[model samples]
Target chain A: MSKLYESQKLALWYFSVALVLFGAQLLFGLLAAYQYLNPDFLYGVLDFSINRMLHINAMIVWLIMGFMGGVYWFLPIETGREVVGIKLAKLAFFVLVAAVAVVVLVYLLVQTGKGDFFTLWFITEGREYIEAPRWADWGIVAVMLVFYFNVVATVIKSKKLTGILGVLIIDLLALAGLYLAGMYFTPNISVDQFWWWWVVHLWVEATWEVLVGVLMAWALMTVLGTPRKIVEAWLYLEVFLVFGTGILGLGHHYFWIGTPEYWLGIGGFFSALEPIPLVAMVVHAIYDAGSHKLRAANKPALFWIMAQAFGNFVGAGMWGFMHTLPQINLYSHGTQITPAHGHLAFFGAYVTANLVLMYIAIQRVRAPEGPALDSRAWKLAYVGFVITIFGMVGALTVAGFAQIFVERAVGGATWSAYIAGQEHPWVREPMYWRFGFGVLFLLSYLILIYDMLTIGKRAATATEVKPA
Target chain B: MIQGVEVLYLIGAGLVFIAGAGLYALLYAYGKIKGSILLQRSSYLFALAMLGGVAYIVAHPAFDTFWKSLLTVCGLTYLFIPKSMLWVMERVHLREEEERKKEKHNPFYTNY
Candidate 1:
């Protein structure tokens, strides 16, 4: 293995913290899942609302950190230079860590405050995913600014800006800029939600997909050893398709948000097309690996990325399409059906993408010890991924279907119908399945963290595999 | 008196399941994913889920024959779509192969 770059080493810090947050996120997720099965599981100790808020926030933050870590790990290699602002990058990491710690403590210790400016600024933002208070939000912006500076500066110093770098820079800016949409206050609930999707929908569907395209670009370069020209061409095509479809796909979200009815058509048509680029990329990877027999150094990373593509198609593309049509959305809007999409889409797109990146970094950090694909950690994560895709997503789909059937289709879409939806065995039974699968995923997540944190120590005694 | 909305949803949800699981079938046909027991089993679980789904539509007290028939059609759609997708992909691969042969016959046909 080659000598480790300083920039890549910086990735370890980001991944470590990201994993900690990932753990916290899933644990909270398990609690929330259980609360559905047993509403009194934690009672007031860790209420479902607080637990859910923690889960969503942790997921968003950890995924962002994972994205940062992936870029920090891959950029130096892509550019053949150290990160330009190494010292500042380190400081940003710590300060972001401190901010996250304080915010979590606030979320846990002082769950809510008076509904005033002071509360919104310092206590909680009261948003779904972007629940960090205004002060924490600003701090995040500061950290993101540092991240952007380091990233852009490194590319500038490299003097070799490829398509990937160009697209990455623009996407990074959009990713950061869109967060502000959620930070604002407005009197109109309809208007507020209109822009809110700019942050949530745009982040998940548009900017984040572009970011994945950029990261996957590098991953393919590493794994398949594909030519830069060919890779860049695909990246451009992918970017073209992603932004082309995904930008307008926000209409799917607007279908019920008191937006104009035209959104139903626009969102339905475009959002339906969002899966094509991802599935295309995954197929290309398979073809390259199968036809070329290109042995990726870290097969687990490749495997997980492949899983992510399939998961994305299922979660975001298929499930989303099922409900995006205004006709369908009318019945299923607020039901468990939404969570069915949310769970799989978030896990498939961002969570697995992070897992892929984490394994890639782990391989480099533990290079020449043994192939990481052959490790206990990879095995564990793979099991977790399976249980999640099948158990978590599949079970949720059943539950969502049940909710749609009982709560809306049969129940006249009434208030009492919503309550009746909760008691139905079809809906309630799958919550247990979801909770069980969630626990398995958490266990796998813990083992992965243990493997990552201990890989350094274990590398000392690990025997290297000789060439076959 | 069956209208269009819920029927469309039931069918759409079925297709979602079909494609979600059936996608792996396409991958399998393409030889993209092979010999991985985990993925293979994962796909099987995905397929079995369709049965579970069909059962819900079939036996749910709220649903009448209209719903059941619609859902049954979804099961039929699921059964056929994967094979059709694979067959279509096979034609694509066949055409690609034909193009390769024609290029190979030309002396000046250089990949470079």
Candidate 2:
């Protein structure tokens, strides 16, 4: 194992924290998936809503943590200087983790019926994505500010303004700014829905898209030996595509909402363009790989990078565009189709990007001697990735299509009809398939984590690591 | 309520739109074309046409169908305008790069 800079070490700690939260998130996700088949399985001990809230909140928190870690690890390298405010960065990490712990505890211990004023401060807001209480929201903002400040300070102090870092900084600022939209309360449901999506859709589709692009550019340059000039040029194009189409793409959510009617066309057209950048990304990755004789050493990291590209294109790009149109969304809204898109999109774009960063960090700190591709950890992680992707594409997609067919196409679109449709053989059968795949996905995640832990030590002990 | 004819029209329009999009994607994915700006902007026209056609066919003013039609027309128009703008931007960038390269080859050119 090679020694790492202080900031990079701090980033590894953040990665470890993210992994812990990720494991917990998947556990809740499995439970939530089970609830889809048997709502009464968890009953009083854990309501479906509560289970869902935990599952999503954990996913969001861990992904953000992973992003933060990536920024810490990469910023110094990109800027050619050490990260600023090292102590404060550490403090911010602890504060963020503490906030997540408190939020999860409240979700578990406190029920939201007739709560006292104090309990109100601690309880969830019952909103999707932004379910954390006001205090936790504020805490998240503070932590983000600290982290953001540290990143910007390091970049500015280094006087190295690379395009990749510039995009990342812009994305971080946008992420923090958009989060404020979710903090305020609104009595009107339309107004609330409007702001809710500003946070969710903009973060996932716009800012995070840019983040992924910048990170992918960095990884291509580092691992594939792609020229910085070519990567940055593509990054510029991505920035334009993401902001130009992605912001307007938020209109898709407003189609059925009480918003103005014109949003249907505006959303349909613009959001339809959203997949272009992702497709471009896949092309970019392929072009870079084909053009350069990449270092065969970091094949796992390279595999992840390629997966991130392909998966984002298929999941976020194709699958997202599949139901993004107003006509299709009219039928598929709030069905299993939504989760089908969410799982693949999140995993492909953000999750895989983070895993690539994790691999890089692991290699840098622990296995600097050589590649650990032959380690049991890498093989298991690869297997897990395959299983998870198959589960999402095969099982979840089948379930989503079945849901749309039975509930909306056949069941006449009433709430009771939809509930009854859940019991249909077509729907129920695919859901069981989803459950089996979900278990496999969970097992894969565990094996991947074990690989991360043991791969470094095993590589250190052995003189030569074989390629898997 | 959507009639049988309207449903068929909607389905046909959707199929046309999907076919156009699928073909456009294949062009980019297979490296038959490069630089997505032009191809993607062109693809939006198909989507807008489909949305407008659906709005006209359904004619069920529910969910703001009329506004949707208006927006689709506006979007289609906007796509062309941006294509031209991006073309100019690319030209300027390429020109600047050329000038920089020329200067780099001139031995007398040095920072003051």
Candidate 3:
């Protein structure tokens, strides 16, 4: 009964890997943005295809790791059972890491065109199934199965299912669909674009959104002492709003992909509905906090969960919905506005959830004494969330909205056209303001890393009475 | 577009929507009465109808455009599902009933 949930440790391992990927993503993002201003910034060092792949791939991996960790940390508590198998959980983690490494290797090899990997998928002389050197894709599938087995075994043994299970099962099924869809895609750019969004855009906005929403509800209940009944009720309501509006939200991605005009309505209407769950989450979180007078056992974790709920609404829901109108998405899809969705949705729905879970993980492992937490550390993390998320959102939105005019209306007529059309106006900002905001975000990451590492005390603390 | 094959597409879509709406209405009524059994039955039936509608849209050549197929599919799904979405609505148990007694005795929370 007292066995430690090995799943949490495995999740943490993935979290570390995710952070490394994030660092790489950040570097690529900076370079990608800079290329607009200076197309030849790193001509030989970074290939566009490779860097874009890494940026998008890393972002996806990081979000997945974060969600996995959050689920691992919180599921047991929600279900009132210790994790079933420790060894299988650890095995799954190693498999995933190996899979990720294989992917990076394959991506690099294909970029160089130095091997048989390039023509394997669509052309002849492709790698044979087990012998094809396409180990990465196989590795990923294997990893998924391993994880599915472990999670399923645990759920069956526990004999108790949380709302988390409902959302999780759907995501798992969606993952299978996405993978299959990816394989079946042809080489046509427009068709590729359509299929690509089915996997990438739909996964994040629709499937993952449901999982994140349900998990947040569970987290709110755990940290804020909200009754399970209320949280469960909210989850039920959220499912209707999420699926009713979410499944077709993928149509938002279909606008510029040579798809038909009718999708505009499907995408537009559903994208508008995308905000419903986000707003519901905010309402649920607030109601929980107010009901308990903002009393939280782990205040920092609670803060992040709430922050995630808020940012998700504003960034993904509000900003995104505004651009979902056919006319707007038509102009906004490839512009800076896409980044506005990327920045907020990534941080708000995924990163924020992980941050809260990380705090909780630190607490459980450290076994803090009494009600006293490391206040400085908590403040540092909260501040980190603020600076990074706020800067990214603010800058990206301005850049996005500004690009609309240059790209669509003016069509790059002159010097202003060349500059604005070519890139976001990051260079146009006052030097001091840009420097200040940029430095603030860098410092925020540094502070966050420091805070998380230093959460544990030096010596064993005296035991405190457990709460009932 | 309203020729023989096109008219067949329209008819198929119409039937899917009508069946879906009927099932959804039944679920909504059952939900209002707080009858979990009837609600669950309606939900399953409605989901089947929705899936069938999506299939119809996908197979029909006249509705091959991404936008139209997506709209009709989504419309059919929403139309078939009850507005309250009782399938997903958690029952707010105000007090214990004979059937509720089973869940109340579930050892997970009490044993902990």
Candidate 3: C-alpha lDDT: 0.59
For candidate 3, the TM-score of chain A alone versus the native chain A is 0.85
lDDT of 1: 0.73
lDDT of each: 0.73, 0.71, 0.59
TM-score of 1: 0.82
Q: Which stretches of candidate 3 lie over 4 Å from their true place?
A: A1-3, A31-39, A75-86, A105-134, A412-420, A423-439, A456-468, B1-112
Q: What are the per-residue Cα lDDT tens digits for candidate 3 across A53-153?
A: 66667777777777777766666665666566657667777777776666666665555553344555322222211112334555556666666666666
Ranking by lDDT: 1, 2, 3
Question: Could you give candidate 2's per-residue lDDT for residues B1-112 as a string of tens digits?
Answer: 4422333344344434433333333333333235556655665565465445434434544335544564455335333433333443345345545544654321111110
List runs of model 1 lying over 4 Å from the truth.
A292-294, A368-373, A453-468, B1-112
> What TM-score, computed on C-alpha atoms, does each candidate reach?
0.82, 0.82, 0.73
Lowest summed lDDT window (length 10), candidate 3 chain A: A122-131
DockQ of all models, two decimals each: 0.08, 0.08, 0.03
Report, to 2 decimal places, the DockQ of model 2. 0.08
Candidate 2, residues A196-302, lDDT tens digits: the string is 99999999998888887887777665565444565677788879988998999999999987999889888987876776566556545554454333444566778
Query: Cα deviation of A425 in candidate 1 (Å)?
Result: 1.3
Alpha-carbon error at A314 in model 2, in Å? 1.1
Which docking class does model 2 fall in? incorrect
